[model samples]
Target: MSGTVTLGMVPVVLTALFFVLADGQITNDFLIAHLLAMGVPVIGPAAIWYWDARVFPTFVDQSADLAANPTAVQRVGDKYKAIFSTRSWYFVVPWIALIVGLTVLNLGFFETVGITGAGDPAFWVYLLFAAWWGLITGIGLHGAVTAVRAIRAVGELDLQIDPLHPDGLGGLSMIGHLAIWTTMLISLGSLALPLAFLLGTEGGYRAVVYLAVGVYIVVIAVSFVYPTVYVNRRAGEIQERELEKRREKIRQLQTQAANLEEADGDTGTIDEVATRLEIQRLRDEFNEYDSVSLYPLSVGIIIRLVSSLFLPIFFTLIDIYLGQLL
Candidate 1:
């Protein structure tokens, strides 16, 4: 992981160094823009990989373990295989298509803005960088999908679900620790370099910022939330089954107690008393289910996760407005 990150950042660091070295000696707009373009793919993937290292350690660890032991065909292992297999076409195809589409759009935008001449080296450089950015973005997205799959695998594990536990999802609370929202935030942050370049020069391109933010919202929804839908549904099913079993037991106790009372014409008999106590115990057990959540996250945690997603957009708007003011 460290090696991948270091290697990925080499181009970006070199580009930055070049700009600094020529800071006062050169004033060519196309040259500087081309250098910045060269930095995009380099910085983007490195930032994404570093963020994943910090926020999604479980996914990283699992991936490493699977890579080390490819023959381990356990539940989680099989799912990991499926994630990287032909099923991954769903993610890969769309990613490539979007990249090609976006590259064309970007080229058209440059032409419309009169920023590129027909034979300009910067134009071709920008095209190359756009394609590179698309590839890196696709790689990051594939990682996100893998992380989601890892989260789902957690639910399939033989975890104990204790109704009395604080998290309400047994020890499966780690499912919430997936840091999905954090990952999404980091992914957005990786685009900061290119976004900064665009926003700095193109005053009329505020729409582009909004479009990026909107697309990020969709990505977050699909990557972070969509993958967990199955986990939530499975949890609910488990909760229902457990509750029904307990409820049936309680009902049986109640019926037995009533029969005892009818036979003796008295409610104070020992058998009736024992049956009542058992029913009370069963009811308490049944009520314990009330505390268990269908999903691993609490309301507070969910609110935090959601808030983190929008904070970037909020800050971006502020930056744009502040830029206008200045």
Candidate 2:
């Protein structure tokens, strides 16, 4: 985090120096917001990689029993390992181009919207901020792509129901928590957007900022939810598959129970009765497993995710509203 703050400070210091040297003033709000928005996106990928360090190993161990074959875990690990390679580093290059390209286009659009501040901003300000956003966004996209793909690779493994899991989420709550952590960082970054208002954008400029932020909010939410949705489908499939198997067994048990009257003697009748009782016992146990959860998340964790998405945005809005009122 401190390292990110340091990277964040580079733009702040340089932009400030440029504005002060050429124009004699800099907006404190833009300075703060500009630093914050870029910083948190960088932090998002770091948090993901940190969580992956732990989540990957634990997920591998927890899902061992559910894999289609003994080698399934190893196969998935190789796929995951591929992500750490230079081949994967290539992933960020295109993101940099896209983000920086958009930044350049927005600069042109903002020019038409009119610069409300001292003349037009120095070209240095444009170059520095755009490069910073491009770099941060590229790094963030790298992490987002890696995290989602790793989870999907795991999701492709055969899901066997594990009702007896201590977490009650089939040991998959870590995944839910991982996504929650990601979205929380994104939300925190969004809080910085409202502060950009302090930079003094007006008319079309304000509308564009709001539109971009709104679209970004939607994108972040989708990024956060996609993995959960993927894993959840796998969970439901496993539950239904396991339940159907037990239903087949129950049908067979019922057929065997119907034949009790054909037993050879009292001893045979006793044995037949015992077999029916045992099947009934087995059926009852699997029925419990069938009732287990079909999601890797708990109700409380879901609430946390919801809060992470809306609370910061709401708080920032209220702060802006009240500030305007005052």
Candidate 3:
């Protein structure tokens, strides 16, 4: 996990550092414009983390003790389900930044570069960041889908209380950890893209930067999110099937329990049959729910990271080539 994060972030940190140092040398309005342009990409993910740390976490105390409480578990589960249901505030921030950032760019640079329009450098830059925002949002959407599927699957599982299975706590930890890291890496990488261009653009590169972001967003939204939605849909179907199995087990248990009580301890045969039936029924119910394990989380998390990583690498390389053109 540490290795995945380090490998993912090294390029971003290096890129940001390079951009920050190079920002000092750029003095022309066009060049300064490029530096400012780089910042647009960072807005959404940074805003997300800030909001989560400061605001979102306030709503739920996710401690182990809290989880142990049945009421807390239900409430927290509902809270998370609701949280992931809507398009997060993170998605809106990019558009806000784009409009606000471009407006400022327009007012300040319009006279020199002209207002954003066809074949205009500023227009292309705006488009680039817009694309980047879309790509990032799509990746985030995919991650959310993956996480939801994982959460639902785990929620369905009838974790054992025995010492041997340990209630499958290890599986839960693994899924949670995967989601957390994938979320962080994707966010960081999104920020690094524009930052790279800000420090490196020669001149007249803003449009190309925007163009790069724009193209990436199109590809990701079309390819990654759409298919992720399908996979998540299938996962939901599987979860539903497991839920039905549990319900059926519950029905069977209730019927047997009723028949045993009706016998009223008359014959030893009936008592023995009742006792054996109860044990089997209970075990069957437990196993029925236990089958809804963490497999979806594991698979979805892996897919999310793989796709998320692919987008950033593609954008970085494409943006580099675009910068060269400028």
Among these predicted structures, which one has the highest TM-score? 2
Tens digits of lDDT, candidate 2, 188-267: 55654654443325323566667766776786787678988888888878777777887888778777766875867897
lDDT per residue for candidate 1 within 33-132, as digits (tens), equals 4454455466666556564555455543433332323233245644654565445467656776765555455554455434354355544444444455
* Root-mean-square deviation per candidate: 6.6, 4.4, 15.1
Question: Model 3, 1-326: lDDT tens per residue?
Answer: 34434433433443344334332332344444344334434444553444344323432332222133545445554565455545545554564565445444443333334433345454444444445544445434544454445444434433322212333432233333334443543444454464445433433457766676666555444433433344345444544655566566767766666677676446845775766677676566556444544332455555665666565666567555655665
**How does each model score on lDDT?**
0.57, 0.62, 0.46
Model 2, position 283: C-alpha lDDT score: 81
Query: Model 1, 90: alpha-carbon shift in Å?
Result: 7.5
Best by lDDT: 2
Ranking by lDDT: 2, 1, 3
User: What lDDT does candidate 1 reach at residue 294?
Assistant: 58
Candidate 2: C-alpha lDDT: 0.62
What is candidate 1's CA lDDT for residue 79? 60
Candidate no. 2 TM-score: 0.76
For candidate 2, the per-residue lDDT at 152 reads: 84
Taking all chains together, each candidate's TM-score versus the true structure is 0.64, 0.76, 0.35
